[model samples]
Each structure stands twice: as C-alpha cells, then as structure tokens.
Target: MKKNIWLDGLRSVARMGETAVVAAKAGIKYATEKPSNAKLMRETFESLGSTYIKLGQFIASTPSLFPREYVEEFQGCLDQTPSLPFSYVEEVLASEFAGRDLTEIFASIEEKPLASASIAQVHAAKLVSGEDVVIKVQKPGVETILYTDLNVLHWATKILEKAVPKVKFASLADIVEEIKTRMVREVDFIEEAKNLEDFREYLQLTNNQAATAPRVYHQYSTRRVLTMQRLYGVPLTDFEIVKQYSKDPSQVLITAMNTWFGSLMMCNSFHADLHAGNLMLLEDGRVGFIDFGIVGQLNPEVWSACIAFMDSLQKTDYQAMAENMLKMGATSKQIDTQVLAQDIERLFSGVLMADPQELLASKPSDLNDIMMDMVAVGERHGIRFPRDFALLFKQMLYFDRFMRVLAPYTDIYADQRLQMQMDPSLLLKH
Candidate 1:
C-alpha cells in the first residue's frame, strides 16, 4: 500500500508539472499571437485532449452559464479523434464478451470504423442472424484517462476560482462536477443502452410513429460496448437531402419537437443532447434520434412547471411565465414576481422586435445571446434554473436553428400541431 501510494503521488506530481508546462506554452502563444481570448482558450482545450473536448462540448450545450463568444467558439470543437487500430477494437470486444464465441456473435465486423470520437469508435457489422448493426466500442483506458484528466481539471479550477473570485458566480467547481457526472455516465454503454430502451418504450407507449431511436442488442452489449441497429439516413442538417425525404420540412421539425416534448413528460429521461448531427431523416421517412449517451430527467414538479412556462410564453403572459419559472427552479429566497415579469419582458422585447428575415439569417451565437441575456436577468431576480432546464432550453435553440433552414418563416411556438397537454396519470404518478 505504501509503495502504491508513493507511485500515485509521483504520478500526481508529474501531472501537475505537465499542466504547468502547458499553461506556460498557452500564455506564450497568447502573448505572441494576441488572438481573441475565446479563440486562444478553444485552441488550448483542443490541444489538451478528451476531457477538455468534452468540457468544450458542455460549454457549447449549456449557454445559460457561459459567455456567448466562448459558447459559439467551442461549438466548433472537434470530436473526430484518430481511430485506434482494429486490433485494439477487437481486443475491447473480446474482453467485453468473454467466454462467448466471437464468430457466432458476429458474422463480420468492418475493420475500418464508421466513426471515431474521443471516447469510442463505431463500426458497421453483421450479426450471425444476418442483421446489420453498429458496434460502439470504448477505447482502452478511457475511463482511467477521463478520471485522471478530470481530477487535474478539478484541481486547476479550484486554483483559478480562488485567484479570480468574480468567476465564482459561474460555479466553476460545480460545473466541473456536473461535467464529471455526465461524462462518467457517457462512458458507461450499459446506461446508454438503458436510455435507448427507455426512449423506445416511450414511443411505443404513446403510439407515436413519427420518430425512432436505435434499437439496442442487449444480448451482445456490455458495459463498454454497445450493439445497436444500424440506421441509414441523411442528417437533418442536410436540408436539401432532407427535402427529398419529406415534402414539408416544417412538419419534420414539428414531429421532432412534439416527439421530444412528449418524451420529456413520458420517459424516465429525455435526450439532453439533440444536436443536428444526432437527428436524421431516415430512409423509411421516420425522423431518427441517435446518440442516447447524454440524457436528463426532471422531477414531477419541474415538468409541470415547464409545461406551464411554455403555455405562458405562448400566450405572451410574462407574469405567468415568471411565476412558472420560479416554481420550476424552486428557490427558498423571497422573489418579487412583478419585478421578474418586468425583467423577462425587457429581455424578450428585443427578440420580439427583431425582423423575421434577420432573425432567420442570424447565427447560433445570436440566439445564444438572447437566451443568455434572459438567464442573466433571471440571475439578477434571484431565479436559479436547474441544469435540466438549461439543457432543454439549449435544445430549443437547436430546434430554432433547424427551423431557420427547414422553415424560415414559420412560427414554431404558435404551431397548432404541438400538443402540450399531458395525461393525468403521467403527471400524477411522479
């Protein structure tokens, strides 16, 4: 035990020294290049590898807590890490499926990965039964590396928070903790497989056929390896191709939105990450929802309040919206609803006043600015939103971006097709 402790101490010291060297290099680059802080920080995070890449993705997804520039810049964070050799992929699969005959389990797995990301690589394969599937294989030692890098990042965040007290409002350590929790879950393919199953159940229970999530093959899946039905489709972002799949892209957005909203009320958890890449127009005409790694759950009260908030917003009832937001967040501190309403009105008035054409042409950062401004106003009014709420809001922004391309002139909020009512049983059970 003593020897193990000594080795760990040495490893920690080495990591700290390495971090210092990287920091020094980043400082020198910033000093010489004088690039924008957002650009410099993004470059530094990219160079730092997986943990930082995940952090960048977190920042991109959660605009409520980040500055618009940093959020926008990190949206470009690349997840396409170079693929490991096929030997490593096979070794991972063998370890995951120990005691099982590989030949009987899979007829063939393509040696080349269909996609490679920081945490896992995906390969197309054919099952023994002749079903086409995709295998998501976790990279070797990713868990160890993730924990090590996160610990180092946690330590550095503490130091920086101490040095710069003003940054505390953003809750740097808390953000790191949130990221750690989510990323740790992300690396667990079993949990993700469960999420996929839950979503599939939601669709079946609701009798909804407009959207679908990948079907997991639990018999062949393990903690670090996921086997799922391979989906072939054009990404929703490819508007031209998506148009070929659907005559009306506006209905596509509506189906996606309604299905997702229903899941928030019906499922155990909602897909927290619904970026454009994860949504596709499948060949069979159903909208495909993939990548169930990051998900969020809301308590009964929060879900009810969210529904009320949406109804209030649609009616342009700012006071009702403020009250619903406060209820959703549930702060113990005394808050004046009238003042909150005024603040929300002031914040949204600019958005309401913007010309439709200009709004459609605006970038994601522009939408983020409006959303973050509302968050800022809420903060001033003692309204603290739950992280799930932030995730949901970010998804709304994503849908807004999609609408810009799919239906430029449509009013998504006013669409009659979206049914916000919930069955009393679903609302009461939780």
Candidate 2:
C-alpha cells in the first residue's frame, strides 16, 4: 500500500521538531561541560545515542579521513546499548513483515537476544519448517532517527566548511555524505543479506570448503529483518575451544587466510571486519565468518597495485615496492620516486630485523604499528592512502594474530600450503 502523503508530511514536521529538541539538549550539555574539541565531540556523540555512536565508530575506523587525535579518541566508541524489550522486537517484525503473523514463519523466537549492538539485535529462532536459524532485527525507529541525525550533521559540516574555508579538513560535506551512505547501508538488512549470498557464491565458485559464511534465508528476510542459518562455534580467539575442534589449529587458521585471500579477487567485496568476534571455528571444523554489516571493495587499478605490491614484497624489490605504493594511492604533488625508494628501503631493513614472534604477536597493535610506520613513510612524501587500504591492512594484522595463536613457528609467506592468491600475470614476479 502506498503511504499517505499527508501523514508523511505530518511525521516529517514532528521529526524535525524532535531533532531540534535533542540537538538543543546536547548543545546545552556541551556548553556546560566545555571540553576539548575532540574529547567533547566524542562525549557528545556518546550521550546522543545509537546514530551518533555509529558516527563515532566511523571516525575511529577511517583513520585516513580523520585527524589522528580524533581517530584515537573515538577508538573507545564501543556499542553496548541495552537490548530493546522483546515487545519492540515483535512490533518491528510485525511492521516489517506487513502484518504477516510471525507464528506462520517462526516456530519459536527466543525472547533473549544472542547479541545486542547499536543498530540491531540477534535472537536464536527456529523456522516453522524446522530449520534452526538466527533472526537479526533492526531496531524500530532507527531509520527515522538516523535520517534526522545525519541531516543535522550534514548541515553542520557545510556550515563549518564555509566558516573556515582555509582549514585543511578535507571536504567536510563529502566526508559526511560518505558517512551517510555507509550508515544508511548498515541499516538495510536486505543489502547485508545480499552480501551473505554473494560471499557464499564466491566460496562455491572457488571450491572452498574450509571457510563459510552463514547462508541467508531471504524468504523470511526483509529490509529491516534478516534470518540466517545458525552457526554453532567458538570464536577464533578462544584458542582452547578451537584446539578441540582441530588438532592443528594453525592449518585451520591458514585455511581461513587462504580462503579470504581468494575472496579479495573472487568476490564482490572482502569482509572488512574479520576480527576475533567475527571469525569462528565451528564444530564441523570449518571457519565461520559472521556479520556482513561491513565490507570493502577496491577498484581494479588499486587491486592490481595490491597484487603487484605483494609480489614485489615477496621478491624484496624496493623500487617495485615504491612504485606499487604510488599506484595504490592518490596524491596531488610531485614525488621523487628515488627518495621514496630509499626511505622504504631503510624502513624495510627494520622490518627484516623484526622477530617472527613479534611480527606474529597476539597483540594486533604491534602489527598495526608496523603498518602505520609504512603508511607514515608514504605520507611524509605526500602520498596518502584510502580507507580501503587501511581495511586491507587491518585484516592482515588479524591474520598475523591468528598465526601467533595457532602456528607460532610457521613462516606464513614461505609456506607452500598457503595460497596467497594474486593475479596470474603478477605471479611471474614471484
């Protein structure tokens, strides 16, 4: 049924009023607190609620787009909102399903949530057809709130840009728009369900059996709700529990690494958030990848550059490494390739001296430091990276941590069993 234009108009007016009231309260609180710019923004976002918390997370994750101070400050932006009452869940389901009786589709939906985060909550459920599954229900009123907050943010960003025309802050409106696009996608369960299906297809196309993402149940899924096959497993971070499933946990980790590497080329996008919580070791001995909320795609040129970069690294060719780094980034200034090579060459000497134990340390922060150092060298020469590169780099650090826990002695790069897939043309450089 088409929505009534008059009702929508009324709702829009009321929503704007609510937004004004909320912004006023936050502004008053800020005035009273009188905190530092970065600190105050973080605090204000936390106090505001879910949409703002997600904005904080965007700042934390996209280090390339944010100031180092802001990025570091927002690192503490964690989502820990209390679960909404099950009655709200039911109402959301009923609305999303268009008055369809949920009992007709679900044999049971546990009132207790499996997990609760800013945008959605997951609950264990059984389908009427007897399939054990998980239901991910988007919070009611999230769309309205998200739009209200983002529109306000967009205007504020434009005002800041106009007021401080000479500031080095890169296109504030563009950045906010980017954030809006990402957050809007996050609230759309239909898109996430599609991501799940695409990943599963990639696995099948590549004949990969070692790692799998949950199969989405589209028949019961909607724009606001997703139903997926339930996966039973221990998180990959739980070393002891993982060891019970497989004697050689290192191989399992390697299998996961190889599968993910293949997906970078084979799939629509790579899983951008594959930290401990998102990867699991299942009872059936397969690695389970959960949460399709965030993923990343690279343009063909950047991807080719990545392939060449890896191949160059394997060959220890500093000139090629420097060349590849230039290709992977965008810069507006002239750069001396020879000088860049020298800096990268010197930085890599320290890299070579890095102990394998430290390189594969369980603490990802160690590996992250190394990645940042490399990026710093590039930045000093006026070459800045995109957020996709950071996502790719972060996943590498997660893989390093897994190696630390599972295969302490394994030289992952030199291991023949691990297929770090790159382009066929680039394989010749190896």
Candidate 3:
C-alpha cells in the first residue's frame, strides 16, 4: 500500500511535468509557424500522457463536437505510440500468470507487436492447443498514470472553464468529464473483451454475414491482457484493395452501413468508433470491425428521442427535431421550439434548396457547420446538452461522411438500406 501511494505520487509529478512540456511545445510551434492546428493539437495531446491521448481518440471519433480540420487531423492519432520492450512484456506476463512461462500457455508468441497504442500493444500468438490468437498486453503502470492524469485534468478543466468560456463550443469541464469516463473504461481489457464477445454474438444472431468481429478467448484474458482472434483485412480507406477484392466497393460499404444501422436498435451497445482504421474489408468479401475499446450505450429514452430526431430530419420537421433534441439532451431549460426551428432552417436552407443531384454530386459534409449552428442555438438558449447526446450526434456526423465517400450519388438521409426505426418497448417501457 505504501509502495502504491509512492507510485501514485510519482505518477502525479510525471503527469504535471509532461503536461507542462506538452503545452510549452504547442505554444512554441503555434508561435513559430502556422502549422495545422489539428496536428499541433494532437501532438500536444499525445505528449500529455494517456488521458489526453484518449481525449484525442474521442475527438477523432466525434466529428459533431469539433471542427472538420480537427476531426480529420486527429484521425492520424491512432494508437501509434511506441511499445514497451519485450522484457517488460515478459515481466508482466510472468507476474500476471503466476510465474508460468508464456510457452506453458502459448505454443508461440511473436516478439514483434502487431500494433502498439498508448495503453496496450497487440502480438500475434498461437495457444498451446493450437488456436490462433492475438494477445493484447497492457503497459505497466498505465492505470496509475491515467488516474493521476485525469485528476490533474479535472482540476485544469475546472480552471479553464472558469477562465475561458469559448475556447471551443464545449466547456473544458464537460470535455474532461467525458474523457474520464472513456479512459477509465479503456484501461480495463476485460470490459473490452466482453464488448467484443457481445458484438460478435449480436452479429451472429442477426445473421450479419457481411461483417464479422473477432472472437475473444475469455479463459486466457484478464483486466490487463486480452486474447482474441486475429482478423486480416485492408482498411476501408484502401479503395484499390477493396476494388481488387469485390466487384463493387460501394456494395461493401452499403453492407457495412446497413449492419451498423441495424445494430443501433438491436444491440445493447454499438461500435461508436467506426473510422477507416477500425473498419476493413477482408479477403472473403466481409467487413471486419476491429477494436471494441470504446462502445456507446443509448438508454431507451434517448434511443426513442434519437429515432424521432432522425425521422424529423428525413421529413424536414425542424420543430419535431428541436423537440426531440430538447427531450434527449437539454437539462429542463426551456427552448423556444419555433426559434430553434428557425435557426436550424436558416443553417440548412441553402443546402436543402440546392438540387438533390448537386448535393449528392458535391457530397457536402456539414458536420462542422451543423455544430456551429448548435453552438449558436445553445448560446441563444441556456440549454447545455449532456455528453451522451454529443457522442451520438458525433457518430451520426461520421456516418454522414462515410456515406458521402462510399456512395456520393445516394441521399444518406433517405437511404432505404439504413434502418432508423426504433423498437416499441425501448421508448415506451423505459
């Protein structure tokens, strides 16, 4: 216990130093050259240790909450950090497995990691019984580091929220709170294992042959280590590879979209982070979803409101849209429906009036514009949206961009393949 306390103190000191250095570096770079703000921001976040790394990931996932440049730039901030040496991996393995040799359980384990992130690194291995697996090993002391960093961040955010009201649309406190929730969950590999299994089962039950998630080996898994099947595929961004495998790349994309849209209603939680890196096209013409570290859960009430919002968007019912958002997100502060609708209309009126074919051809993504409008609306009315609604809206914005890239000729809102309906029990029962 004394050792643990000492370690925590050391972590706190390290985090503060790191944060300062990162902040200084960012300030220097911004002052010296007009570098891409998104790139500089991501680099600074990476330097601030695990908490900010996770925050960068969240920003990469949430297009609706940030500007387009930031979202697109942070996409490069994948788990690309250097891994701990193999000696560290071995020490962790022995300590966790009661001094047993890795060979005792695995027939073979690769020294080279398949991928390394801020918190963990994955290695390809085979179980002694001959099953192929990918082992995800957590870096030592990551939990302590993450905890200390988040605590410091909470204080920092509180200070910033008081000092700067408009650094970005989101208050520093709210953003830090959201980051804490996600980072805590990410530090536990067991939870991710469960998420992987649940998603696999959901796909199986739904007979979703178009896509497949990896299978987890729960027996060999722990809070720090996860063993799962390795999936081989090219990321969806490689249109050339996708074309070589499938007759039509757009068909694969549609299947992926349809599968995800269905899961939003049927599954308990859906994969909230579906960037090009996380999605792939396998050799067998199936979409592969990798990484379940961050999933989003929609309560029944919120799900109902989301359905209403999507339907309203399709029908251009701005009043209903405003009402649904208020119910789903706002904290009791009344917003004038007519005023909100008028604001929304003003924001989208030009885009809507453009020829449908032109809209499809140009493939205009309006997530940043929409978020700016939302911020305007929020400032006009004292309605601060909860974090969950912010996350859902971010996912919707990502889907909108994905559809534009995959099928630019199709109207994403009116896509017959995407299912937006809700189950009766979800809304009414809860």
Q: Could you tell me the lDDT of residue 347 within candidate 1?
A: 70
Which stretch of 10 consecutive residues in model 1 shows the poorest summed lDDT? 353-362
- Model 3, 145-178: lDDT tens digits are 8877778878877777678867675466776777
Better of 1 and 3 by lDDT: 1
The list of candidate 2 runs beyond 4 A from truth reads: 1-37, 307-316, 332-334, 346-363, 380-382, 422-430
Backbone clashes, each candidate: 0, 0, 0
Clashing pairs in 2: none
Candidate 3: 10-residue stretch with minimal lDDT: 355-364
Write out the backbone clash pairs for model 3: none
| lDDT of model 3 at position 361 | 34
Model 3: CA > 4 A from native: 1-11, 24-42, 57-79, 158-175, 300-304, 355-365, 400-408, 411-415, 422-430
TM-score of 1: 0.88
Choose 1 or 2, whichever is better by TM-score.
1
- Best candidate, TM-score-wise? 1
lDDT of 2 by residue, 1-430 (tens): 3464555556557766865776687678678977677887787677667789988977776766677778778868877679999999998888878868889999999999999988899999999999999999998767777887788888888889888998677488888888889889989989898888888987776667888989898889989999999999987776788889999888888888888887776667788878887899988999999999888876656877877877776566879989999999889998888899899878866775643233443356655556666787888899888878887876787787777778777777667888766455532332
